[model samples]
Target: QVTFSHCVPTIVQMLLNAKAAQGTDFKGWKITIGGSALTRGLYDQAKARGMNLIAAYGMSETCPLISGAHINDELLKADEDTRSTFHLKAGVPVVLVDAAIQAADGSFLPADGSSQGELVLRAPWLTQGYYNEPEKSEELWADGWLHTGDVAVIDEMANIEIRDRIKDVIKTGGEWLSSLTLEGLISRHEAVRDVAVVGVPDERWGERPFALVVLGEGRELSAAELQAFLEPAVAEGHINKWAIPQQIAVVSEIPKTSVGKLDKKRIRSEIARWQKEGSAEQTSLS
Candidate 1:
């Protein structure tokens, strides 16, 4: 039997082929996906093969493995709806971890499925302090709990759905928009291979989201098509219509930092340079 703990689409395909060659005597599979975000298409393919796949969520601070979907339980089964929700959620906290969502004023809110707050945790295996940095450690645990820096909402079932990073959430005209949610929705388009949404300066809205997109090979998508796809989301009030990007830049690939995460800072710098050069060229033409 072969099981995968964390894998991308490419690796999952390889495992599926390998399992088929092993014959009917091979035992069932148990797979867990816990890194980055898994698309709905990948989840459906794995579930169809009777491969027991569960979505797990955690971070490095808690020695990872905070919570995971139960493989055989009906309540935790991965279905179309569950898979969609699971992809957005961080799952319920593990048995040993004490997790809560708190407001800016440090008051605990009810897990009524609509309130949003900062995720804070206290667990046995969590790190105690930052090595050789007492000041940083003190700041990290100011309220006697490890501040996760993630904004999330907990439903009645205690499932913790991560909305966005506190810093990454876009505040436009007094409304907050989730960049992660927007990115996931945009990436579902066939022409889009990968996408990222970042908050950029706007005089009217305070801040607005700008899309950084990577298209599939030989696929060309216009800014209008991207905007059209987002129209329904805006109409439903999931995002402000005005929050949509004024420009969508299609690139060969999004640059990532050494840690393999999207480098938004670098993207912002590039945008600034491009604007400056464009202004200089227009001045010379005039």
Candidate 2:
């Protein structure tokens, strides 16, 4: 029998959910998940099916190996909830690399788990330039740190929790909200298999979170139900009350980029086109 195999979390998940195996044949299979944030929902689903999967975080610039959650005695002794919290993080930096979160003003933030900032890193093995693009290369290495552009919070234990991209973070009513956080919460619904949240412009609030969700096979859900599902997160203080998305649309699938990241730019453009067409229809009816 093959002792191990590896692939993206998405592919592993799809294989595990296949009807032929009845979810039992994949036991003890080893997988390395990367290229995107592996949400708790997918993690739990894979675990329940008896697959051994791990979360890793990095980029092409760093040669793609930064942090990985390796289960140890303490992690193995922890409860499911505790273990999931640790598993969901990007884990500590690997050997020879330095990672830290820095405030917008270039000040370093504490790794107490709540202070949000952009993740900056320095490593000898990291890529130097962008193929003759000196300006972009300079921007990438501004202040001698490789600005990853990823917004994250680091716990006292040094586990990195990626909150969202700096450009994707939603600012509405003078508050900054993490689209990644919202997407994670919404994916907890039984009917939701995947989700993507993007910030869209608003006249009154400056910007709002818009969600596109993919439902599980044979599952049905309503936008209001999805909104209701997130209401408790607001009360629990995981998110601001107003941070609950005003727009939750059920879609067959969320779009991804060439490297399998959520394509927010295209999504925003699509939403703008829809809003324009909707306005034209309303004007015609009037």
Candidate number with greatest lDDT: 2
Against the reference, the lDDT scores of all candidates come to 0.69, 0.81
* Inter-residue clash pairs, candidate 1: none
CA displacement after TM-score superposition, residue 196 of candidate 1 (Å) = 0.8
lDDT of 2 by residue, 1-286 (tens): 5557645656765675688867366677667777777787788777787776677789889997888776678889998888887777788888888889999999999999999999999999998889979998998898889999899988877788888888889988987888888887887888888788988899999999988888888999887888898899888898988888878777766767776677888877877776887641111111
Residue 237 in candidate 2, Cα distance off native in Å: 1.7
What value of lDDT does candidate 1 attain over all alpha carbons?
Answer: 0.69
Listed in order, each prediction's TM-score against the native is 0.80, 0.92
Count of clashing pairs, candidate 1: 0
Q: Whole-model lDDT for model 2 versus the true structure?
A: 0.81
